[model samples]
Target: MTGVPTGWRNVLPHLDYDLPDDLPPQSSLSGGVKVNLPLELLRQSRSRAGTVEIPGEVLDQYRRYRPTSLWHARDFGEAVGARVPIYVKYEGANISGSHKLNTALAQAYYYRRAGVQEVVTGTGAGQWGTAIAAACAVFGLRCTVFMVGDSLRRKPYRGTIMRLLGATVHSSPSGLTEVAAGAREGASGNSLALAIGEAVEYAATRDRTAFVIGSGETYSILHQTVIGTEAIEQLAARHAEVDAVIGCVGAGSNFGGIAMPFFADAAEGAGPAPLLLAAESSTTPKLTRGVYAYDRTDATGFGPREAMYTVGSEFAIPPAHAAGLRFHGTAKLLSAMRHRDQIAATAVGQVEAMDAARLFAVHENVVPAPESGHALAAAARVATSGVSDREAHHVARRGILVCLSGHGYLDLAAYEEHLTERLRDESPDDDLIKLATTALSAVPIEGGHLRVP
Candidate 1:
């Protein structure tokens, strides 16, 4: 097997276009200028380095579960009548039960170095909270998480896991912060965005506490490039030729982790580039049907404005079994890629995605996370599409790489709901989506950008 990568790939400078930097901070509810964050992280967000070396401490922690297994799903491919080989990169070996630990450890290390005592953040489905909680325990820092109220109710065990890891968890829309108070009266009563706003306000109002983001930030996505870089070496050792790389999109970091290297190679003309696909839930229409615009990054306008494909930061988030996929906007980098036609996105129905997870479990003896199930379902579609790319001028199918971002063992509650036929699909409102887009358009554009925002 190939070893872990010493450095994480950074595709920020190679995106073929420049992205806007954050504007001056608007005053938050705490009567502060902005959220207090680690200066190193803020610098990294603007860095154009092709590759940043992973600190020794972070590397040591990564080695414990770095080289995640990548197996050829021949049995599942045959069962699904695929014409190409299906390879799955399973990342469930990590203790966090998801790929989020990759960034959580890096952030915690940076925070601890910056002389920060405590970290505050938000979570969805509790994976990011659990990850940050464990990282804080390792780094000798305190963690506080504001999880979506709906997600906390459905996955109480996840919150329990975070608490067991020594984190203090709170349900969003609670009386913790004034931002959450606004959320309680707004359309986005309980959402990842609202929780982020609350976390930012709390951090800004408190001393020695910094607000850390779990996903959708530029630095967070850059830190996750290890997943894609390692997969590159593993595929080379196996001599596997890939035609497509697929992953489920929440705020986009999970998919970015596995596809950044491939996309970077394509931009550099290093070799043949595979088709990139983003799989998301139909309920979260950000990457699929949402309009690209400059929207507030967090709820209540406490964060910077970013150009992304968003269904408006104020839209009522639909409750889906895959809570991680309930976010209303895609990451800035991922939205940029989509705007440039560098990737394709497809929405999967709730029931259909769970069935795909069950099929994979029955055939491969592994239960994928509900979010990853969307990618698995997309892989099945690509394999059975019977369509060929004219650019390649050949009907030859090579392989499809699926990033199984996490495991479903801790998410049995969702599976139970699905098995009992209680899970159903929820569709987005066209008029409401249009309303959100229109409001974002009037937010006043800040800097130079492309067809993106």
Candidate 2:
């Protein structure tokens, strides 16, 4: 097996601008205070180093599937009519079949060392839940997951996988916690925020269990930097230089994982200085349409008040095959960078994303997860549409590097919908979006809101 990256690259130290501090976790009325983070994770969150050494155990586990293949993707580029060299880093090659496991294993290692016997978290599409469950099993810890209701229905297999991994899974708003039970039924009946709130509440009340996030948070993003670290080395080995780093933005973990190394170079005026681009779903276009604001990280308003580009925690999430991208808020770190022009983001419709995946599958014989398809669509958009409106990102497209966050094998249901042309292409309601965002006025945005160029 190829040697795995021993150190995880840190993105915080590479950024020039400051991401405003989030409000501390509020004391849960029914279940004690919410935050129970591990010490190492908190340290990593505050780290400003170029790289943090991976724990020996975590490094050992990563050997199972580190150095995921970086493909030339010539067939896909030709099919899309791309002129530049196109490459892709496939994160789905791991046993967990997604990038979430990168952080899951690390968190489990830290929590186990910290004497935490159980770990719990919410999942939008089930990948995070499965990763955590598998990690907990490896570390001999108990696991629990709160899955979004819509996703639970659309992808029951995700829940089944978690259960098989020894996780106790509950559908969000399942009456297990007040936060879940009282959550407003939006378009999808449950949002990612609500599921996360339930997990927080569940962890808060339980003894020796901590709520660990898969994405959107700094620590999680740090752990995921292995993706970019490996990609950089592999591309250099192939004598390829990248000018653009693209990935889908589902809380920005996968995007940050693959782009942050290039982002560091851009900040330091070194290397290729690639254009860091994030592709997001139109239905939850926080980076594209929502204002920079301070808002609760969950539906219950009991979690931390995070500074991010948000459509509001209460925004009704549209029911889409890419459940992972249905969250209302972008990651705080990504939002801050976008505001400062260090990163660029664009949103595309479900149909466009799905069609891009179709093109990729036909040419490359590897179906991209519907969430990752957004990045695929953006790559095609850049290749075909030219850099007319994206001057902020870059005009140069020397070589395109796309992060195919996961495999679409388990997401065949979405493909079936796309093939039959029965997939509902739903966009977020403007009126509802306005109504939902109105609550942001209640939160102070002085330090949080940055002017977008």
Candidate 3:
């Protein structure tokens, strides 16, 4: 354990589960056969225990960049004419420039301890892949990243960085895997689900190789709690009360990381909880328009079926500049929280998100990743609305905390497209959404009681 503050340990056990129960069984399809997931990982995912001890070596490595800085965005707040103070937790200060590294290092350390020689995983915007690749290099392990085809083609720099870290990067839905090869036919864009399928397929056929996922799992969320733990302490030192905490959601790792600690306070009746908000891409509005149901975690149905808000594993989402928010489903725990009315979600189009990013850059002097811009967009929306009604006591002053999950130095092209108005603001039509729902209806769901079509 990396010396967590007092009372922080009390929040850990309740972070994932409110009650003790058996972990749900999940089925994975490989070689046209359905197989159960490994029980070891499943047990850890279901465990209610809050804290996972960080190994000494992992902690030593994290010392280089772990406690990210939280900045009070006074200038940005002034430009937005916000009546409240805005704080940005900048996770882009690290080498990989994203919060993904928080879990990547932890995962790599576990793989090295288990004697695994290689780790295979999927990446959408390439941040997770880059983070994991860097982590593997530090731990003297090999990494194979199956990057989403669209992202691989559009963000060549991300792939270059991963390669520079000594990781093998392949464009997913390519000819590398039989399943991806078949699925690539006539497909216009690549999704996180498709990349996951490719990674799982490759890992299943090899020995001493393990498939790791960047998000949508409890362990990933557990590894991410450091973000919230740090944020709480930082805010306490400033004597600030957070009215709301917002973050962009793909598989909900970052949002869950920051929000869960506050939720623990609410759960224990220790303090008033901050409003939890998730910002998502309008192109793939899983939280805003998706149905709560049991859906496969991967495109080819080669992973566990999670109870989440999904647009179907087979849904073909329109390409957006915020590639990191292109996943089909959210984390199961986040989905459950939304279902229980514990969180609120909203969708922002690429154009609006870009506009928010530009406004942030001009005032804050930091270029935010397009995915993180979604949270900025949401913050802007709240600021524009005065942010007073959301509070219970109707205080004279208000505070908003936005999780700037990553920097966008590698995403200059995306900003250029937005500035040039080449990026489309339109979302997929009703017909496309219906097509995705229809595909989801065909998949058989077993464990979850809720179904949406």
Candidate 4:
């Protein structure tokens, strides 16, 4: 490992590491993954059928907004405690107000390089779609976004933004495709139904478009390391070292991405790895409470070998407030790490998560998305406990990292509902569990000592 970055060391205390002169390139040995096509193929004429680049202007625009802000939550500490130091990588400050762009930008870069003329994707709450649509606008590629109809009706600002950015935005169940047709036939009222899996499947089946997913276990996990890389630098600048790192996990992108590098460092004997903890909603506490199993993503008989802790099959999930965390399974890569006992997991109830968000807003002056409150609450719990004694100090000295994934502006309606007592507390019902177990039984390949079909 190279020495710590000088810029970071100046701000953080007791930091260590040699800072490399250049950022490391993506490793070919992709941790139990095989690249179906060399990354270079993304940019070659042979692969793209002759598209050359993402355009210099777009690259320049991205450079303006590329690297985002990181901060030590000093105020958060005052309320929680002084012992546990909390640092947050505030992706909420980004244009789309979330870390979705971290992966979206990379995917766009690859797709444009691959000569893909169009990008197709789906969004439940619209953050991912907004990020990708913005990236496509900059890259001069056409973007097609399928938004869950309910979210579209609720968050019109997102749709307006997509159009202004020059992308085609459609509310799913609009009868544009078979997925929409099926949804219409099924006919649920005012549903938040972008049909993410269906949208991705449609894009993948096309030769002209590259399918993009907002979040997945591994894909986003790979991109989120940038957060860890930056945080490590920022903490080093502060001359500080953290004992634990905590983040909320929906599809496992933000948490896995940021923690993996530290885990790698520990694996290399560089130092101790922070106790990595992933927080999920009790309604969909797949990681901490789920039985490990081989599973499918969309439950629709599509998706990869999504090996992870998930509530249901990908195609189907019980409705939950944290819209993004509704996926059926986790990323296979993150799941493996969990099995190896390299990370810890926890699940918080919806009201608790919401209360955490309110507390954070009152203290930190930022209204966090409900998804992010899970980690915030977890970190707060750890910080509140005394750390003066060795046993308690261990708890206090922990480093808490929150991936402020996105702002909750689009979700204000939900918040309003919460305040008005209009929203009912809901969770994974027994029927949902039965559905999930049934989906798990469909997978043929079995490993990791899990019960098989």
lDDT computed for candidate 1: 0.82
Candidates ranked, most accurate by lDDT first: 2, 1, 3, 4
Winner by TM-score: 2
Better of 2 and 3 by TM-score: 2
- Each candidate structure's TM-score, on Cα atoms with residue i matched to residue i, is 0.93, 0.94, 0.89, 0.79
Per-residue lDDT of 1-453 in model 3, one digit per residue for the tens? 233332212233655434212233244444432222345446557665555566677677777886778878988888877878888988898878899998788788877777788899999999999999999999998999999888888879999999999999998776777677678455525678888888888887777788888777877876777778788788878888777888999999888888877887777786777788888998888887787776778765655567778876777788888989999888878887776657878889999899889999999999999999999988877766632222221221468888999999989989999888898975767666656766443222335344432
For residues 36-98, could you state the per-residue lDDT of candidate 1 as single tens digits? 567878877777888888999999999999888998999888877889999999888877899
Cα RMSD of predicted structure 1: 3.0
List lDDT for all candidates, in order.
Answer: 0.82, 0.82, 0.77, 0.62
Candidates 2 and 4: which is better by TM-score?
2
Root-mean-square deviation of candidate 4: 8.7
Residues 1-453 of candidate 2 have per-residue lDDT tens digits of: 246889988878876656777876544456565446777788888888888999899989998887799989998888888878789999988656789999999999989988899888889878889899999999999999999888888778888888898999998877988776576656534588888888787788878888888999888888999999889888888888878889999789999999887777566777547778888898888887777777788877767788888888878777888888988888888887876767788887888899999999999988888998999988887766644223543444578899999988878888888889998777777777778777674324445343332
Q: Quote model 3's TM-score.
A: 0.89
Error of 2 at 40 (Å): 1.3
Question: Which residue pairs in model 3 clash with each other?
Answer: 12-50, 13-50
Return the TM-score for candidate 1, rounded to 2 decimals.
0.93
